[model samples]
Target: MEQAKDLLAKGVLKPGDYAYHEGLSDWTPLLEVIVANSEPEASPTPSVGPSLSTAPTPKAKSNATLVVGIVVGLMVLGGLAAAGGWYFFLRDEPMELVKTTPPLKVNVPPNKEVEKILAREIGIWKITGHRLPVIDPETGGPGKAEDIRDTIETRWKEKGKSTVSTFSPVINGKKVSFVGYKEYDAKDGVFIWRVKGEGLPETVSKERYDPVTKTFHGEVNYQNNTRELSTFRRINKDRVHFKSKLFDADNKLLGTSEMLFTRLEKKEPDQPPMTAGSLTAKEAAEVMAWVIGKWETKGKGMPVGGEPQAIEITMEARWKEEGKSVEFKYTMEEGGKTVSYFGHQQYDEARGIFINRSKWGDNPETTSHERYDPATRTSRAQSMPVSPAVGSKTTTVTKRIGQDKTQQTLEVYQDGQLVYSHEIVSTRIGRYVEPARPEPAPHAPQNGLVAYYPFNGNARDEAGHGHDGTVIGARLTADRHDRADSAYQFKLGDHIRIKGLMGKPKNVTLAAWVKLNGQQGRSGADIISIGTSVNIRVDSKSGTGGSSRTGRGSWLGTNAKVNYTDTGWHQIVFTFNDNTDRQVVYVDGTSMAASRNQIPIFYEGRETDTVVGINGRERNAGFETQGVIDDIRVYDRTLSAAEVKALFHSE
Candidate 1:
């Protein structure tokens, strides 16, 4: 008490410092009690010593009683408040407190939480893996990826404000589909993914993040019947997983969607990926980016599926890494099926030309070395679809007719002969149509293993049959499970041969996982080629993939439309039941169109003469499997459909 009095006399201790009481659980400043108990001191004179009060101050009994009563009243009130707090804890309603306006600040960061989110989202993130559902056209809700490669890039608009732009890649170009913002209310705790531009009012989604699980979930709240719940979970530093659930205005659950993304590494826009090149990888990539959007034919059309009527041709372009090139997919209706041509383009500065390689149907891949004239703004090339056969020259002039219209004039020459050529106009389309979820893959096959070629470490066979395959030009690459695991990657002239492994077999079931770097090729891309006699192979002509096991069928399964040649690791199984004279082909565990040939497997070469990548004797015209193959197995007996399905699920 003496030390406290001395400090108070020196103005070092304030009245509020005495905030605790002997029996209290909570701290409250003793402002009133301390001030009343403190005696006022006289103004300081020249002397430093404090003058003591000679007379003692007397207190009345009534005053003391009053003070004691006040203290008792406060104690009772505090206890009652504490008990009430505990009682209302289970109620959902939050306790209200006296609110006050915050003082205006000059320069302070708003919502450090938002800053953390933006930090993780600074660069472009592309949708590489996806599991979104097909939207019901009538419901008008979210759907699966439209463009094969969907992307989003974020940027800071200002301090505490940000923008997000969504992108989609077409055959040879890219376009922005949607742009929005990350906004929050200054007075409330609500954070939003706000979209307000063009002709509509703002659309806002209340977003929140959980640090513990690294999960982000939000709902787009508006007056309409749209109740979209979206979530994003960080899989790692470079990857993020997203999901969406739709709900009606009444909060009833509707449907859901999902996608996975990998953040694109940032690079210098002007630097090329390769050091020794006329056009740097970056420059070629930039040029390719300009040509990546979708282009559709105008009012005019062409014959489709042997029909005289015109059909629309759609071309989409997107960025592909390998050679730092751009890839294109040209799709059209032909022969009652969707036919697609895939191609890649790169620039050669030394040659002052751009080279385009396209493969489709039975047509040999054409490599066009063309030059772009900036003055004429035209593209011209001289090449042939077939080498050393009939040379052709192509010249194209494109002019932007309108904001969404482009007119192109094309002229072609075959050898010295002039071909029918004319001017055609195409319209620029934005975004893409949502796609349905892809069919699920097959489970792995267990038991009854005959010839198992995991292709791990070496081409040594694991089947204990000693029918090992000899790897030729194929290289070992990362398998589906892990980067350390190995798979045979075949490109161009690469192949594998297993002598006497598959020849003159009464019944044989072959299954393997294949990832096609180039699903499209001259003639067809063969997974396995039997060089012996009958000229049989599992091949895809254009995009209509079919195996000889299912007699005269399209790539479509027994049901509706499907293209089995999509670029991915698909488990393909060829089941030949000699007794039943029946054959079935499965893609990723789902039954696809197959051809039937009861004739048993036979070959003219030595027994077990089997080949992969390319078929001998022009079965597929040397169209090699430019991709990766893994976990290949050749069983002497056919697997039941149920067994096949179980195998797919097991993997």
Candidate 2:
């Protein structure tokens, strides 16, 4: 009975639970037994008569003292035995040492319910739906989308005796990542999640699971006292639905989001890879970068009943799967009725062509094969009929003009004859900006160097000459050696200008590392120029490299293309020797052009500033450099062949 009471007080046993002891017929309610009389005290013995004599005999007194000493000695031995039993046996078990003992902590195994919940969530999920756009009540227009999309991967891990699940959502091309951990609190019947990541505030949230509905409801607290009410429901083994509503500090509803997650199926080991044409998915997607923007077109449709109908069309394109594919949406309005179409485009390696699949509401899908030319910015596509029995084949020729405009021509053919044709001129929604990527910075010796521009973030001269240049519309990029911000990339209208030397040198050599862009043509682009007299430029007709003067025409022509198609970095050197009457142009350490009868370069006293990327005298688009330039150096004396080779291999 005492032991039962002690266990009940410490909460090791519940009061209402049944318990049994040696004397009980069967287990009985602990409550009923605890309240029952604890082994009733022995009935009091009958009262004995008082002794009459005040003193006893000596023999009788000695006998009473011996009896008292024996009882004391036995009690001491029993106490020592009880202490030893507690130290060896009962120390590891829960015990109620006193009436104020705290409740014992139970170390029960995790329940099956928590494991089942975690199993349903631990898998790779891809977002199938995006947050809906908020509509403007006044204009009835929708706002832009938020939190575009990404893949989410989660797994459950063991931390000591507890379960911890990890969550990370990854977005392609972005450096930021989110980390989260979840643990179950059985006492509170809730699961808690703590999340933190780059550029995000730490959050701790609690959620309750509903087994019947397979759903979870939670409240997430953010910074500034703001909170969000969120719910997640498992629709099936491979799908989950999530919704959240954000609330301000004052409890005002701000916004809401909804998303659908679909588990990614595992790939089969024997499945072939996805690829197209001569390019990989990423390369194929990048070839469409010029068209990945909003565009609008207005044209007269094919003649209908002796009159052409007015047609308006708009299109938007975006990259998907990290540039493996391109997705496009377009809206067309004809005869006052609007129709929309969505399309996906990718390269088909087997077909050696680009393929486009398009669909419209309730309409049969159409597929087209296109042959695209990057150099010409043109594509010829033959689109099949939505139904083989009803429509003729349509051919489309699209030509991109400059950066912001495109022209498309469509023709329908039937019975081997052209039936109808339409033309469209689409203008981009905004001004187009060309992308220029940086290259690795190369190294070179400083011997006899007059001016050197490493271009490391700034255009400061590093050759002990105060000839720093002013940069315009240029971006710092990695160099030839993959050094970040060690070089500069130049696009259209980008250049660097430095103060010209006080006087012309008797013999001079100009060298620079250049990486030509894909858009460079066979003509009219200047690399470096000093005034109008001396310049290293792409010749007017051949795209070959050369140095030229105003009256002398070209002093030296390399007759080698500027390496636009090759897409590799190359070193260009132009040396003029006054004493030998020789002018030599070298590309990648080998002399491509040399002149023994050339006159010395002349510099007028009023020469303009030294210019890089374009002509010093002419600042037009015709002479704009369409590439990256790095590690430019000017020397007062010509360099030998060995020194030129060293500069080329320095990287």
Candidate 3:
């Protein structure tokens, strides 16, 4: 064991350096060892002890440990060498070898040729794939297979090929595979071409024959960790039909399908024409002319005749005469009452034709007609009653001439026999005449007039004037004046007397403002006069015959009594109804007296001219008005009590 340890230390017999030979039960190193022997000397010396191979001495513990350490160190060195060898020679070596084959060329027409073919084909033959040959068909060569595939795919897109596939088969006792296809495309003008490939399924696999393009247009899985390949092809011209297949790792067929694609058509467009009747001016004018004029007819008791049950018709139509035609219409009244009646007269074309229509009370057929008669200056026609059973009559004539024209006479006939005749002149000579002198235009009362005179500015005296009176310079002081009388006046010497005037003096209203000064005694002292013919007086001195009576009197001494005061300004209004023998007087807005005993008698004789400022007794007679008096207004018609009050406060 000691010798063994020494040998081991000298790198001679480590446990792993040798293996025990099975047959020999001895250890031997597996590696061949070369030994160099110098020429052996001729003698050999024999050892002296028992001749047994000297039993190896037991090794010391330290030597054995040293030997084991040496052996462990050699083992570690051997393992490191093996690891280094594996890393340098085998770790990064490629797992797969790929042969990049050049793309196969398809014997198809050029794009220009295909385009022409597409135009003629119209509905079939779609080109699927094409490419320039990268490798000679006779000699396989290396090329960029992906670039070739991309070129082929681009051509297929352009040509629209279909049904390209790869196929595998046994040929001539050898397993061979190839790509086969067919292309139905417009480039082939509706025909399909079959294509086949050589030597592809063994190193690479293809699916099926598409009969149109020489390409593998489907998925192929390889067994030895090869990349899968897939192809696509289009078959139809107007529509597209494609074929695809998948292969397994053992190059076995997995699946297949025929897919179809179709194209859409277009659609055609929509399109309506361009020209219409209204009233002419002449026709409208003709219709409008038949509605204008005034017409009149008289029956019993009408305005023209004095019968209680008279019927009268009057029509006023204006501005409806047109060229050669005239129209007129009339309304009817019977017995001072209205009854239904209508009449229309139309003349056409200078009296060439005349139509007369008359309707009365549900009798529409009581119409007549007339034609122009140039020789007689008339229009003559026939007439019939509303009942058709009644006989028709002849010679209804409307005279066209003025003044002394042919008259119209009515003769009723029954059964062609005259039953009654009524002779009436429809148009008379001088039927419408102008008067020698034109009548004067009627006068309307100026009811809204304001008082014009009287210088005093007191409003109480101006009450009945409908407005405030103006003040002016006068004989008396401006602040001390008498009320003006609206009553017409005549003067006895210089004494003003109230009297009647022209133009219907029967109905009269006398309004004034007055203020009495003293109860005086006098005769014929006039407050107002009608030209010395009639007078309105106040006798404040005595009640009756002594002129102390406050009363309103006429020229004939017919008087109506009233009350008066010597206080301030007061409005006095007097009204007379000669037709009814009644008289009324108002003070302020209240009625002082309404009397029938002192009736107002219309004065027949004319009076002297009117006077103002004072009566004819200019020395002692004016108004005994000691205070201011102002406006007055007179009317030719009797005024009611309400009207007098309204006028007082109207301002």
Best by lDDT: 2
- Tell me the tens digit of each residue's lDDT in model 1 across 1-651: 344434434555433232232343222222222332343222221111001111234323232222221111111001011111111101122222212112112122357766665566655666543222223222334332322235554544333345333222221132212234565555554445543221112233445555666655454433334344455668887887555543445555433334456768542111111112235555555555566678797443222233334437788766544345666767888889876666667776544457776756555566555555444434554444534332344445555554556676555554334553555677768643323322223454545556777765456566666666666667666788854326877876677787764534567677777777655356556666544332223344433332332222212211113444445667777776768866667767777655455555443443246677775433445566778888777766778888777767765
Please identify model 1 stretches exceeding 4 Å from their true place: 1-448, 532-539, 542-566, 594-596, 605-608, 618-621
Give candidate 3 misplaced runs (Cα > 4 Å). Answer: 1-504, 518-521, 532-534, 541-565, 597-606, 612-628
**lDDT string, candidate 2, 421-514, tens digits:** 7888999995333224233235565667788888755576777567778666566667888765568788766788887752467787888888
Per-candidate TM-scores read: 0.30, 0.32, 0.23
Worst 10 residues of 2 by lDDT: 77-86
Number of residue pairs clashing in candidate 2, backbone atoms closer than 3 angstroms, sequence gap of 3 or more or interchain: 12
CA lDDT of every candidate: 0.48, 0.55, 0.33
TM-score, cand. 2 = 0.32
Q: After superposing candidate 2, which stretches have Cα over 4 Å from the reference?
A: 1-445, 550-558, 561-566
RMSD per prediction, one decimal? Answer: 30.9, 31.4, 56.0
Q: By summed lDDT, which 10 consecutive residues of candidate 3 come out lowest?
A: 268-277
Which candidate would rank higher by TM-score, 1 or 2?
2
